[model samples]
Target: MMRALRALVRKDLTLFFEDRRAVVLSFAAPIAIGAFFGFLFSGGGGGNAKIPVRVADLDGSSVSRAIVAALEKDKALEVKSATSADEARELVRRGKATAAVILPKSFGEEAVNAFFRQTDKPDLLLLRDPSHTAEAGMLRGILTQHVMEVVSKEAFSGPAGLRSARQALRQVSEDKAMAPSDRKDLTVLLQSVVNLQEHSTSEKTEALGPQGGIGVPYDTKEEEVTAHAGETYNGYAHSFGGMALQFILMASIEFGMGILIERRTGIWKRLLAAPLHRSTLLLARGISGALISLAIFLVCMGFGMAVFGVRVQGSWPGFLLLAVAYALMASAFGLLLAALGRTPEATRGLAVFAVLILVMLGGAWVPAFIFPAWLQKATLLLPTRWAMDALDGVTWRGLGLASALPAVAILLGFTFVFALIAAWKFPSEEG
Candidate 1:
């Protein structure tokens, strides 16, 4: 049985290697796809890294300059200075920039006066498309922070702090502690000075409830530095590499059914007459199927490295072990399919639907984290999940062999179970 399996596997390997298109589709296609998408994602889809933002300031004041400076502080944002509102809008519409900021002419003056009068706050106009939500939201945050800071500075320095000082002095004068008019005046004057010092330098003072106390300005230097540290690899390539490894495993179905075909064509009968046991023939085909899978896996990985800048930070031995285990499992599944289906049409149609569904649910198209709770739990029973998890461990998670042990073990278990099932229903000859 073992000898016959070896012979069958050897023959399959020979056929696969010799057929140029088979070699290309099984191996080259996945690698090419992995490389292309990897490059796209690693390079940020080849779009502009800096978010182009247009700024139109009718205020033409220092306040506008300060706001622009604050926006520029965020590395993700790029301020394109515009002289008019029309130009800014045109820039946005033409896709030259993401969004535009339009400051009203009386923005600063109204904000300052509003603070003095304790009235409504000034408003800054934001012009943007609905499609640019993230960039617009971020630009709005920076601008709002700047506006609040400006308003706070003006309020504390100009009149708000002054009013609080005088009110406190008036309370002290009315305390009537056996004081003459002239003496009360002196006390009020002294109290006013102390109040000014306390309000103006609020860090040394305690909170004054809902009225809000004056405070030193907050430092946003660290926030600006960490928000965008350096370059980022693309998501497109990473996803492509993972999907390629996952979907290519489906080739096992073809190889398995090819065995049944050879039997129908009398090839298997001739091979069986060559002093090869039936079990040996099956084992050889399994080994050959695994080799083809591993070959495809390696080529895809190589493409990722050469084109997409993906680095596998895990143990190479561990990765190879997982890959071989997954291949074996995929081969076993194909054999199972062949054992179940009595004919070629049945195998092809059923295998395609079943394999595609498993791959889709197994995080081949989307990450499993986004799946529902019950679906996530169900994935533990699926070999594709283990395969994807193992690959992710090597590529993204920086995990070694130890981390991939669960996945490898599960794949091996599946392979064993599948091969056993196939053996139970093993066909004596193709019908």
Candidate 2:
């Protein structure tokens, strides 16, 4: 019995190895996907990998320049320059830059004023992408820290510091936000500093802005902008689309299996021998497959909306257009599978493995934004990627009908390619 079991195991292994496509895809899927997931989960961005940001220095003063330089020196950030705040905003919108920091005109003067008075904050604007909110939070801290460090040193020792301190002393008593005791304390400190400067011009002291290290010297007004109709981003709205895609494609694979079974069982020979043209038969099958896949997607979406708070935040018509286009693409993909496959028995493992890899590359398992720029760009050629992007844009992104059209067009283009190849390869004559 042991010898027989060993022989059986060897036979199964040999059979599995005989199908080269199955072996390659079966093993390749895990390795390729695992590497990406490992990199993402391990906090594995190296020195070269840094968050990209745009800096707009409208002030162009020595102080503003120093702040920009400090941000450039930070290892965690990848900085680029924009000539204007409008240009910086365009960068964030285009996805060329992840975030933007705008230093308005006279920001340098206000920053110096802020160093002495806790209430006086320099005007700063931060335009951020909603998708990169977590990164934005970290970036906000980095920006605040660098601005304070650079501006504080400037406000402490320079001739301007004495002038600003004296100016602040006059305003302290009139400031309504300050408590009476706090106002008096600030008044005496400023008075002493002005007196010391006048009496001992040669004496100098190194100071890091406020004595107790006050909060950020700049007041930032942050705005989240993207091509969305919704005010906020909903993660599940896009995630459910990913899940629905997987389910729809799985159904398509089954459709291919059905075609293979019919071909193997002499159904094709009988059907072709009749007056019916092969193209008509193929078209009917695709239509049925498309309808089935669409049903599956709708059911999945229904559940997602009921349970997960997923939404059609964008135009309803646009969302439906994406879904229909994806369904047609899936049907064409099914036809391609049937044409490539020798038999249902031979194709099942390979087809399933291929689907998984496609889904992974499509960013169903992991978000594509986490991918390096090049990989994200490369994945755009894929129909799955196009579908996923449309899903994101129309759902969480709140994009309009116009935005969805391009992805729909791409999906139809892919469908045409898949159908053309399937028609060329599909066997009409019985073996």
Candidate 3:
């Protein structure tokens, strides 16, 4: 068995070296993809840099002034003011602002009304580009968190203040609804006051400008909240490596198709007529395909590390064990593909499509966490997703062997199942 395996392995290596296409597919493609995507993911689209936030407060009223003050306080953000919502939107469109916050007139009144009525709505309009999801979400998170606290407080306490105001409306119009413009204006006024109140109490606090609109109540304390350094690593290395592993496995068709051609040309029958056992033949093919998968996997990882500075910080032994397990699963999957695809055309078409679909759903195309809750749960069944998660745990999170054990176990199970199916389906020469 050892001699047969060595001979088969040597033959595979020789044939693979002689074929430039095979060499390119197995080695060159991985390195190229790693470098290209490494740059792409690390470029402007990634969350590596801070984006500016523009503020436009039209109300100029005391409330708008306070909210503007709060805007100037966030350190993660750089604030600029625009004259109107249209101006703010244009700045966002021109990439001058990652996002813009507009405080319409009457913002304070709505806040005052909502506060008195115990309602929690504050009307601050956000203008942002749809393409910048991460930046938009981040800005939303920071602004919303601070704004809501101030707005909600008004919800609880502002009604009492409104009641105490000495000036009463000359007439209350009953039949007509409040204009949208008037409602927006009211909300802005209340929020500005709320913004002013919150920042005034903090360590870096400043008093609100008395009815005289000074620039928004600015605070220096918020600067401390945003001062972390270094490039952001969004855990893309493991994901890229996992994808490389999954696709390299598809190259098993190089061997799988080779098997069929050999059979048609009487190579298998001739080998069967000799002393070789079926187990030896099958094991040789599996090992050869697995070695190819491993080589491609390693090349991608090395390129990623050398070029992109990504490293596997976890246990080396644990990573190797997982790699080996994943390779076996990949090899088995290839054999399964060969067994199912009786013709080269069918194998190429069906295998490519199937692998693509699997990769897409497995979170190779997008992180599994981004999927809907149900889709995330569904991804558990895919071998690629598990491989991605395991690699992420090892390389990105530096997880220990104990934590990666479940992924290893599941991958090995998949290998066993695929191998068994291949063994059952793979035809012996005479039979």
RMSD to truth, every model: 19.1, 5.0, 17.0
Candidate 3 Cα errors over 4 Å, as ranges: 1-150, 153-231, 234-236
> What is the full ranking by TM-score, best candidate first?
2, 3, 1
Tell me the tens digit of each residue's lDDT in model 1 across 1-431.
99999999999888767755445455644565567445434543333256677777788666556667777776667787888877776555434566777776766555544543334445566766333455567766776666666554544443433444454456556767646886576565646545654665665543332233233222111111100122232343346556655656668778867976876678878888787777888888888888888787777777777887766655677788877888888888877876776666456656666676678667677544334445556777898877776675555434567767888999999999999998788876533
Cα error, candidate 2, residue 394 (Å): 1.9
Best by the TM-score measure = 2
Stretches > 4 Å off in candidate 1: 1-237, 429-431
Q: Per-candidate TM vs. native?
A: 0.49, 0.76, 0.53
The per-model lDDT (C-alpha) reads 0.63, 0.80, 0.61
Per-residue error for 295 in candidate 3, Å, reads 0.9
User: Model 2 over residues 1-431: C-alpha lDDT tens digits?
Assistant: 99999999999999988888677767776787688668755655431246789999999988899899999999888899999988887667545577999999989878888877766687799988776777798899998788877766665555666688788888886789989999988898888766755544465555335343345667898877555422665667667898899878898999999999988788887888889899999999999999998898888888878998778877789889888999999999999999989867557777777788778778787655566656666788888888887787777666679878998999999889999999999986776
Poorest stretch of ten by lDDT in candidate 1: 219-228
lDDT of 3 by residue, 386-411 (tens): 77766765664455686567788998
Per-candidate total of colliding backbone pairs:
17, 0, 22
Better of 1 and 2 by lDDT: 2
Look at candidate 3 and tell me the lDDT of residue 278.
Answer: 76
